[model samples]
Target: MTELLGIPPQLLFGQLLLGLINGSFYAVLSLGLAVIFGMLNVINFAHGALYMTGAFVAWLLLSYLGIPYWAALVLAPLVVGLLGILLERTMLSRLYKLDHLYGLLLTFGLALIIEGLFRNAYGVSGQPYPIPSWLQGGFNLGFMFLPVYRGWVVLASIVICFGTWFLIERTRLGSYLRAAVENPQLVRAFGINVPLMMTLTYGGAVALAGFAGVLAAPIYQVNPLMGQQMIIVVFAIVVIGGLGSIMGSIVTGLGVGVIEGLAKTFYPEGSATVVFVLMAIVLLLRPHGLFGRTRT
Candidate 1:
């Protein structure tokens, strides 16, 4: 077997696959964070808790309520998104006129509260979530055994990320969203319901996080800590991708996943820090991020 740079193809490809899978989760989660941050100017630290709620909701539906995975995929996000709307209406909306840091602090407190509640209910152990029967097997590609579920996750996330981007970048509704973000008073003057739009945007952002949670349940042990574990890395991804660039969040997310995988293969000790290192480099090179554009 030919080796490249002292690494075997089999191992290399396997790590790359792992990286891609990690990237899928990162892309979806970070995109959600970007959406909420860009439009609402709120740093939603509760995002990870929402994600955990998503997984737990799906698990609860299946184990206790007899709901299927497919149904959960649709319903879990809706439930979570509705909660997000409530949070916005009752809590987050009040912070809009305050410093953006206030929103971040409020969300952080919410995260701690949610995670603590889950921990009290479920304890620290992870619960296993069965993979849907239809996607239980793997394909024998010439070079790799590609798990059907994993492959589907990658494809699905890509479709969703781009679809969201298209909706925001191309659609008329997106134009209004952008306008509202820039000047809510002006948008409302045109008869657009800016408050309602803000509610929907927050819901949409939380929905994305919930969707990611559903996808992750099958792959990871559905635990209260799962979202917390991933969210830190995701925050790093958001920072590196540029706080306000949707495309930047998606691209940098996947790219960093790949790099992290390679780092694990070559220098396992460095894998954890590689993302921060990359962020440092990106910050040094492009302070506003790779794709961020000035609004004016």
Candidate 2:
């Protein structure tokens, strides 16, 4: 076995692969946060809970409804997205005109409510989600064994991340979304439904979180607190990437994930704190974030 920097090639590659997997989740989740904050100007504190909901939804669809994994992937996001729309209609929509803190508090309370309900129903234990049969194997590279599911995750995340970037940066509806946020009165005067656009944008952003949840269901146990654990890391990613910069979110999330993985390889003690430490460093150096514009 070849050794690099006193570590076996296999071990090094394995950690890097693990880092890429973590980065995938970070990219997708933070992208959603970026979208929501950019358009709605509301920080969605309940995003993690919504992510947990997506996983649970996938679990329920499988356990009780006998729905397969492939179908659940599509259905779970839609289910959660609809719920998001409902939440916006009844609650979140009302907060747009108020202080941003109100939106944060409402989302925080919603997160607690959702997590509590799931705990009451499912307890703190995590439920198992089986890997899809098609993805049940591994590839032996020269240096390491790569699981098919992990590869799928990385590929799917890349596709989704770039696809979303293209949608927002190069598409028609996306233009309207940007325009509406910039000048709702102007967009509305042109016969575009700005309010409806906001609702859809919020739902879409929440759905992205749900989509990531579905991707994670098989990798992580389906538990109520799962989202809580991941969300903090994601928030760190968002800050590192910049609050509303879509490309920044994707790039930073992946970069941080890989950096954290490397930290685990060289210094195990700092692996957990690596992201936060980077966050602090980034804050000290560039308070608006890596891609954020400085306010005058």
Candidate 3:
């Protein structure tokens, strides 16, 4: 077996693949966070809880309603998105006029409530979600074996990320969204329903979180605390990429994932702390984040 830097090529490639898979999740989750913060200006602390809800919804559909994984992919997000709309209309909208910290605190409280309810309903143990028959195998690719489901995740994440970027950066609707974010009063004067747009944007952002959760259900055990474990790392990704910067979130997420993977291979002791260390370094050197623009 060929060796690179004294590490077996297979082992190296395997870790890279794992890192890419993790990056996919990070990109999707962070993209959602960026969208919400960019337009709504509200830091959604409950995002991880919503993500956990998405996976649980998928699990419920499969276990109770006899829904297949394929169908749940389409349905779960919609269900969660609707829930998000309700939360926004009833709860989040009330916080817009207050300080950003108020919004954060409210969402954090909501997260605690949601997580607590789910924890009470379902024990802490992770429940297995069987992979669909069509995606139950792997292919050998010269250097490493690639699982079909994992490959699907990477492809789907890339497609979704680019598609979102295009919608926000290219389309007329996107232009309106950006305009409203800049000056809601002006956009409203032009007869656009700014409030509705905010609601929809928030819902869409949460839906993205739900979609990521569905994707994760098959990979990670469906457990109440799953989102809690990932949310902090994702927040770090957002900070490193620049808060509210869509492109920054996607690129930083993938790059950091690969870096973390490499760290695991070269220095196991630092692997877990690498992302935080990177976060600290980025804060010290470029507080606005790599892609964030400094406001004069």
lDDT of each candidate versus the true structure: 0.92, 0.92, 0.91
TM-score on alpha carbons, each prediction: 0.97, 0.98, 0.97
Q: Could you tell me the lDDT of residue 192 within candidate 1? A: 94
Candidate 3: count of backbone clashes, pairs at least 3 residues apart or interchain: 0
Task: Please say which candidate is ahead in lDDT: 2 or 3.
Answer: 2
RMSD of each candidate?
A: 1.2, 1.3, 1.3
Question: For residues 1-296, could you state the per-residue lDDT of candidate 3 as single tens digits?
Answer: 33637899888888888889999999999999999988888999899999999999999999999999999988998988999999999999998878889999999999999999999999899988889999989999987999999999999889999899999989999999999988899999999999899999999999988999999999999999998999999999999999899999999989888888888788979978899999999999999899886632
**Candidate 3: Cα lDDT at 133:** 91
Residue range with the least summed lDDT across 10 consecutive positions in model 2: 1-10
lDDT at position 158, candidate 2: 91
- Candidate 2 yields a Cα-based lDDT of 0.92
